[model samples]
Target chain A: MISFQHNRREFLKSSIGLAGLTLPTFLKARAESVGSRIPHKAKSCIIVYTWGGMSHYESFDPKPEAPADIRGPFGNIPTKTPGIRFCEYLPKLAHHSEQLAIVRSVHHKHGGHQQGMYINLTGKDPVGGIKAKSRKNWPSITSMISRFHNPTVGTPAAIRMPYSMYDNGTMMAGEGAGWLGSKYDPILLRTPAGKPYAGVNRYNDRELKLERNIEKRRVTDRLGLLDQLDNSLSHTINGSTPYERLDHYGQMAADMLLGSPVRRAYELEQEDPRIREMYGDHIGGQTLLLSRRLVEAGVPVVQALCSASDLAGGSGDNWDTHRDHFPKMKNRLLPVFDKSVSALLTDLEMRGMLEETLVVFLTDFGRTPKVNNNGGRDHHPGVYSLAFAGGGIQGGLTYGSSDRKGVEPGSEACSPADIHATVYNAMGIDHHTELYDQQGRPFQICDGEPLPII
Target chain B: MVGTFNVMEKLYYIFAIVLINSVHPLQAEPEALRDIERLNGIALKLPEGGWEVGFQLRGQKLNDEDMEAVVRLGSIVSLNLRDTQITSAGLAHLKKLSMLRRLHLERTKVDDAGIGHLTNLQKLEYLNLYGTKVSDEALEHLGQLHRLRKLYLWQTLVTQKGVNKLKNINPKLDISLGIDLTTIVVTNQKSEAKKKTEDLPQLEWLPEEGAKRPPDRSYTGSFIMVYFENNRSKPVKLYWINYNGEQTYYANIDAGQRREQTSYSRAVWLVTDLQEKRLGYFVTDQNTSRAKIPLE
Candidate 1:
């Protein structure tokens, strides 16, 4: 009689299981159903966003065959891969070609920085007037990937370092969690070491300034205050209310500040000075270093803006090279970027973390093929280049190509959505899966197929 | 007819139960998995088969006993015991994980004895034994791991002879024998000395009274360093003309003192008195340069 009763219960449980599928359970079911359809190679992801549009002609897709006006002054050099070539300025990165998979035909329609950045980061087209904190916007790639990750206690699911993206004082949209809500927003952390980028870095109360040197006792005191507030408000709040979420953040902040491995990771002085020099003594380099550390501390996703926080009309150490582009790329930008990124790749490889940690490169758009009278390239949305390394990505391969004149995609054209899908595929996420917004409206996460590069 | 319907329902329920159990395959020992996780070990189920367990993050408290619990779950494809308290004895449990492809035992107390157990892990592709006390004997055991592609012997007791011997066995293996620590210090010192002795290009200073007033505002350019020397008798205040043409105060350099300032090329720096009175200005270039405040 008891066995009969248990069988009836099991029948009921199986019927209801499909409807009550949590993320982890759903993923497990999906994994089992697919049975090796997707390879889950990436344990963590690091998105390196070059805020301003990096030039394809100068970085990955050098058109030595193009006319002088289109090719600019820099010559091309052979990479480790015999057929592949990079700009003369990026010699260090050229040597690391074996680990890089450069896609040269990524095209998008949005030419403006805001829309271009929005499309690149969110993998979604921008509607009218998208605000940074609006919940209606699609979650950033970092936030969306983080939603699938279940980090250990007190560890953030996602983190973005240095500072937020801004253009001419206005903060860019699509950096936050968006419709996924604040719970999934990547925590913003300030890099505590190295030379500062020559531009404005605005900070609000929400950013975790680890450089403040806050003592453990002060964190305890703050937690005590929060405890008092919780005691007073616990009765008023019923379930997971906004106040409760804020309380949760407070506790997490305390945990990170008091004794979390993340706090120890922030102590850059503890790192070997040799490794620090390898990454270069720049804010951009240190941020990448911090991203590696956070991944070591179990943060699932980290987005590093590898440029100045604000692109004040092409005035600082940013990729928006409106004037003097050749000299800037030669002297200031390329050296640091080339050295730091190569160092990161070497470090991760030596530590044996590269196999499981995915490093991706994203940008606003590509620079124009023709050098303007001011010796700079304007925003060219026709086509661009991006790259992926590690995390099971097959290296020393170029997936697509731009036209000989460097005007637009010539072959194997792809979109930013395809890039996002590739990332999802590497991270073992079903890109076709659906997520619900706060209003319980279901939306498909990605609308593109994963590229075969992975 | 009623007795027949009851039997049919019972059989249908039994079929559903079997299907559900097969699909879910309840974890063999949930409590044991939880126990290992409680010690800050992460056990992730891979999409293919087996698990990738890592205890590198906050797993300092984890000891040899935890390995026993880890092996109980079985089919661990990748295991990271970096910076754990596990000794040689703990590795005995790892023999059950024949499917293991990657193992990180760096910065642990594991010696040659621990590595001996890894010989049977024929499928292992990566082994990180950096910062261990493992000697040539460990290498002899690892030579049997023909499938091993990467081996990190940095800071280990293994000699070049052992590495060469292993290389002879598997020529395709990528071994990393990291550089000595002492060389890094020497290189850093050499670089610092070189930087100090390097000459900086001089910037042409425009007196406040003479020459066309510097452009109303600064234009953005590449990053460069400027060494500003206040040679004037009185202390001078330095301000950078921002992109918007506003004077943003940067530093207050005392007489005869030099300040190393980071700025972008084509940026304008204005020198002033303590009372906010403007004196002269200098414009930065692409290279690291010296901006000397005139004595006159």
Candidate 2:
């Protein structure tokens, strides 16, 4: 009787253990089935973030019928699409409308720059006193998307060029890998060649100047010096134990500098001069050119901030046109933007890279409908515009719309999270998928349904 | 009792094997498909019961034998062989992929003879033959694909006549012949020449000892090109006043040398002697103009 009881207990224990092991397998099968439903079209993503709030009325949704105060001084020009019209300043981009899917009904509630940037970048509302590089925040969209991509060994998973986003002098949050740990943080690289944006750009000292003159023997010594500098900087910036000791960024930098496709991609001088001129000689144009090269070099995601690094009270070359809005948009901003973005589309199509590369335009909330006393537009979180192209997206289609007055969403209202969900859907990431934090706490990556634009 | 326990253990082992197999159904896939995957070719299974194979990344070593391995997988919906080492002879193996919906043969060696095998692929929707050696004869073979929606013949030997013929067969077909590359270059150069002759804002040269000295540091501004004509008797050192107000050496302009310097508007350029004594400076503007250093 005793032996029989022992055998029964052992049998139950084995059955339970097997059941526990098979449960995850069954769950994985279901998860994969859900994921395979969405065809994976984008192998890489290029995020064009216009730092300050890019005016919807001036870029994609020009309202000719609105009052002068609401419509501002810009006129509407007909695009390739019959019914679609863009601001007169964007004549070049108007020609490429067939390849763009403009979303004019995106809106959020954040009015401040930091809060608005946090929502746009991470697709999550700020919780409380959120600080940059804090582990309690959500992972940025670039970092999250890059986590799923497996690039060739040596290439950084994600890279943000030129400079980090800053307001006056304060660095913005939602630009780092939060709960995903420091490993998934997007590496910041300075655009080696290009005219610098007019503003006080902080955090420009972290660049590795791998000039051709550096001898092979001194390479090791240079790398060692970089490591020490990075360690000390990380300590001061992070205000915690060094994250590099736990991440592979230091080793990856060495690997890239020693000789990799990424190193070759950085030599912009080798590109055809005509192509460089086509992108324009501005920093904005060069940044987009570098983005194309980096994508070809196998970097999964790249975020190019199109505006000046710092929004120093809208004084320099930023989209923050709080004063002299018409002159700024017509002279400094529109020409470079229209030319470079159109060149990118044309270049990608000619090389057959557009089919696999996704280009997205994001910004803070749209400008207000009423012209301000300063002769500029104020922050309007009521309704705004964003755009997506390539990577299997149906072009020449406008997904949503604002009212006639350009104040609020009139039809197919969507949020920044919904746009994020659409991107994940295009890139083959299941929006409802859960990722665990360092503490093993599972969090749903996104909470919105994907738009039908795909 | 001992015998019963042993039997239960054997049942557990069988159940575990079944569960593991169900979890990884790819284990049951043919070894040829796995071999292609080992070569970094993606063999993703579509939810609608077909495979999507791509060799766009790391496909330099792929040859005719690899195409045979791809055919063995059977139900491929989309196949991307762009930039691969596959030849016209290798495309003979693609005849078996009748279920293919989208095919990317761009930048490959596939020509008219190779494209002939794709006529039987009735379900094909997208075909990209750009940068290939295909001529009008290839379009003749492609026109037979009635369901083809998008065809890219850029940089090919195909002419407008071939594209028109394909369009006649299927009026709904979207054919892209792309712009000529050389024409763009010529036009851009012409426009560039025209721009140089246009009116430009001339920058004022501020002598070092003059009342109106240039700003100590450069400020960020729009991109512009400045033509510096060194009329001085000796070679002068050109230094850019950096954002930090520090002197960063850029180049040395020999006497009577014309150096085209790319700079930004509002940037200050200081000219000095070989001994680094400042002579004169010029602040750039938003137009391309000439900055000539006068002989003192």
Candidate 3:
């Protein structure tokens, strides 16, 4: 009985692990492009970060044929003008599938949101770090892109709209640039209030705290300069660096506040009010619209996170739904995301920015195939989907098929690094390019391949 | 990303091949622990007995949750951490593990007052020296760890032999030395290794290559990845060919006598301890392909 019990536990553990096993071809292919993709295709990226994970079954990849429990209560609807089917809640993005490429096989080594975020952002495993979450997290791909490629011009390469978030006071994992250092941190825009209004919460207030620090430092700098004093040593010793890579950040911050295209990047009101209304006045919708403005303003990468609060508060904007998933997606999550994502894609393509800008809707991982007694899905990293549209990728195409039971991928399985590699490939950054830590030792930026999406 | 390294790690998470260098990789040499160069590939045999764990490596990604797993497995006795990114802010979490014995804070950001809180850990055996900014003045507060045997005082203002005199006051105490890893070689089991050049299924071509001369042929083991997965159990012929495409075949167990006069094939075998999860090659020729022959 003890042996049987042990075996049962092992099976359950592996069921989660096995899902992360797929996707080598993706990383390898992407790494192969590292040195070769330098003078290439896409030049910019727009990341639509649904703060919480979104339900695959309720949005892009509906399991209409599955049981009622797995399929939830939502029904499918024809999107835009065609045969493409999407959950009724995601009505906006449905019509634009022809321009999007969805990968139902994307997965990774860890299913937890933080771990998944590590894979997505760094294209690597947890390496050496504490799981408690801290402000010293690894950097994001956009940071790497900004670090590698810089902006289209010189307007500070990366931008994050409205605000960057933390979970319950603990820094959210994988949100900041971990090993990449500070030079690549996105210029987080402090959102202003008004209609199609910028949203704020307890989280926003925290963002304000960060804004205060930036302000205080500015005052200290000005006062010290007037006194003809040098506080360089204090800045150097305390901030972990003697002002090497970190030096660029202060200047970048000053540039943003002083106003330039960088200042104008997150301003959505400057856009025709009708267009803003079309995208909806909600927090998520406005952020997506705001992201496009940054891209237009020549920001190479823009990250816009829609709140988990937009759906339900406790679980975090993280889409890890241990329960109540069906109601949330069919009600709050899907409709808002669907409308905003759809608007961004349409607006970009219509403006012809779609060719140069890669728009990605990514989450930590997908929910489970089966629901529990709690009437919701738990974390299911095994088989979920991610969608990519525009920016040199084939459109209206769906790659990789999951098995009939939707328990695992029946077609090609992919790791998060593969998706990250593909993004690097599209952006013309060598996915294989090695990054040296403060020590000169070389570490491969990504080991995964470009999801045969190209 | 999908790669051998990633897959290998997923297959097994218990391995402790963690790479830790000075938090400031840019410095010419790490400020502390210079004697401890590389721990990336070292596997350790964790000892038993004792309950204590503490470290300070500020800013380093400590994977704090993993420590929970480490302590859950058994009692953590001693920790040696010096010149790390872990900061004082994280020290608050360390206090919860009341079972901590000897905490090493060499070159850590922990203040003299922070050391005072650890007074509750009565089981601490050896406290490392010079890891923190604590002065000899702070030694009075550390008097709380009565169970403490030896206090390290290297590179600190505290005279080493002098501290020994103070620690010796405990009549029942027996202070000792501490040690970490020296060397460890981690290799995957045979069942886990595929396409191994050392052991494989055989191919027969002896009479086919009638050279009679062992002098005419050879086998060369590849320096790169040398393994393959095969499932067969028959006596077979293996061969080796040089750059000129000249080949030689050998099956170590010859049924007949030597063909001294005839131009027959000769065999050279690869040495392997074929104990399950393994297949040993026979008569490898240094000039050509690494093929397998029967073990006879």
Candidate 4:
């Protein structure tokens, strides 16, 4: 178990003064409050969900030993780590490999989009069949963080970026606060570019749309306003009412939109010309810069979505690339992503947030071992790759290995639950602790080992 | 050469309209068909009870399926859909406006469908389709609006299109689009940052122990934008207490939406002259994402 004193020392050093006076005071006040464990090392955890299946071939798990058909057509590049290799396009991230570990073998039983996505995201089978969605209402990794670690600091405990959209109006389910209850729900903030015209709008003024595109949220006043509304509108503060939850969420949203000093970080225009240039002129680099800013602001969690621009395409830039996969990965996707992620690792280590800030890159699932008729690999949940760096995770180590054809986990087939369990364990949560389900039934947070990552 | 021919044809029509004392003798003027001097494009709305007044699909969701865009006749009025997902490419065919007034393409994605054809709006007034992609070049064609009074130029590149001199000629015209960045997000006092360090006190607004606080604090602020890093960046949630030690802030909620409905709420905060301190900001998974001011 992690010690409180050592945790506090590391927290002060890693967080770069995030909690300011708040955390130190709370750590001291713990003597009188709950006799609870002071989550010391990094008081937060950030799980990056690279939504659509990201391709390991062009990213982390490049198989240089394989033929052009299997390895696709990208050059293997060296990293700061002695022998670890990345796609040539990922030269930016190559320099920071020392801070990361590429988990080469994570397999699962689900392969369909809905099922694979469900299992990897919720850490369990959908409960119902493919026809029926995951109605089990399992808590997302972020939801658990919000519930178990409501640190007395930061503006939001959990965050998703850009925004998740679905076909028609159906939003991507399983990314929200499932059985964890409403109070622990994450404040879902969508970024919409505004159009200014009229002098009037319920949103305030028309001219004010100038400030419509920044990322910061005003947090303090929002809370105070909610408190005022709560008192004037209701009798007693119910611990678990939709009213309180909505008010709480609304206040969090309003605060983020209005208060947090995060807007500058989100705007790529604010970064130094040289620094921005290093990351390349793209969305991924801008996101990396913003992520760094958030960790600095004392936010406990930050989830940056890593997308393949388009998920369809060669050697497998997006894992599901069916046709025209080769050129797309060779030209557009891999090179851009590589530079940005590389720049991120270097920036984090330079800033020192790498110690407390755990950066994880996880795709929906891996690719098929057998190439399809269209020259693309379909979904292969049997074996995939994930990467974790910083936040106490050991580096330059391959935790598991896949079979020769990359057909399955040859050495150790780690399930999604095991990965989630390892994440919670790294952050000091007892991996086997049973969290309550919606019905008050206890369910283990993760049913796997920590992969001996340390 | 065709444009030249059209210009010559328009001059001939002008001569005939001026020389002949005919009521509806000439269906339309050539210059009205094109050119900035005789144009009035802003109020592209139609007159009531004049023509068939064909249907318009405003505020409806659009898609990639081929759209049948047509307007036979009728004075279209009040396209006051300030915020819709319509694009300039979609609104390309609405150029034949014989009787349109109060065009409110304020938030539609209208572009230079016809920077030259815009001069066709003879009776145009009160034009706002401000947030469209119509650039300052569109302004050159807009010079024909002698009767145009209110022009919505927010979020557009009109100023660069030589509207500075145009505004001088039409001083009565109200031209604006967004926050006019000259006002906010800028520091007049080049020394403002320094001033805050020296003048702005450390507002210990955190209430004293057991001290009774005021009814509450009423605050107003603006959220310029929100960026979700999808995965790595943290969410925004804050908690606070008053001077009397009363909990004043709430905890986490995603996008901070209302539980039952879709909310489009923006917030503003209040700050006194006292030295106020901010605890850490609640971030989600990523390292950091910044929040900006001046609302772009």
Give the better candidate number (1 or 2) by lDDT.
Answer: 1
Mind giving the per-residue lDDT tens digits that candidate 2 earns over A256-286? 5545567777788877776787787778988
Is 1 or 4 the stronger prediction by lDDT? 1
Q: Which interface RMSD values do the candidates have, in the order shown?
A: 9.0, 10.1, 35.8, 34.2
At residue A85, give the lDDT of candidate 2: 93
Judged by DockQ cut-offs, the docking class of candidate 4 is incorrect
lDDT of 3 by residue, A1-454 (tens): 4663343333222322232221121121222233344544465798877654666777777778888767876788876545456777776677787878888877665765666656666667776573422434556876877776543112667777566544445445565655566567666665552223212233443232233334566545533432231234223323433232332433343343333455554556677665665566666777778777766655778877766423233333245555446544554456567767877886766444575688887777777778764345766777778888888888777878667656678789988788888898888777887778664667788888898776
Q: Write model 1 residue lDDT over B1-296, tens digit each, in one string.
A: 45744565455434433443454476553444455545756665666666677788756777888788888767678888998998999999889888999999988999998888887799999999888899988988988999999998888998899999999988989888765655654145346733763476789998899866788778766667778998999899999887778887777999998876767788899999999988989988888888989896
Tens-digit lDDT string for candidate 1 (A332-372): 78888898899788777777778789999999999998776
Ten-residue region with minimum lDDT total, candidate 4 chain A = A193-202
Top candidate (TM-score): 1
Residue-level lDDT of model 3, residues B102-219, one tens digit each, is 5666555655555666666777765655435555555665666788765644334444454555565554443322211122222332333333433433323232234432334332
Candidates ranked by lDDT, best first?
1, 2, 3, 4
What residue runs in model 3 are displaced by over 4 Å at the alpha carbon? A1-37, A79-84, A131-137, A152-154, A193-214, A218-254, A309-318, B1-296
DockQ each: 0.18, 0.13, 0.01, 0.01
lDDT of 4 by residue, B7-41 (tens): 64455445434532132233432222222111111
DockQ metric, candidate 2: 0.13
Off by over 4 Å in 1: A1-37, A211-254, B1-28, B38-40, B159-161, B178-198, B201-293
Separately for all candidates shown, the number of backbone clashes (residues 3 or more apart, or on different chains) is 1, 0, 75, 123
Task: Score each candidate by Cα lDDT.
Answer: 0.80, 0.77, 0.52, 0.49
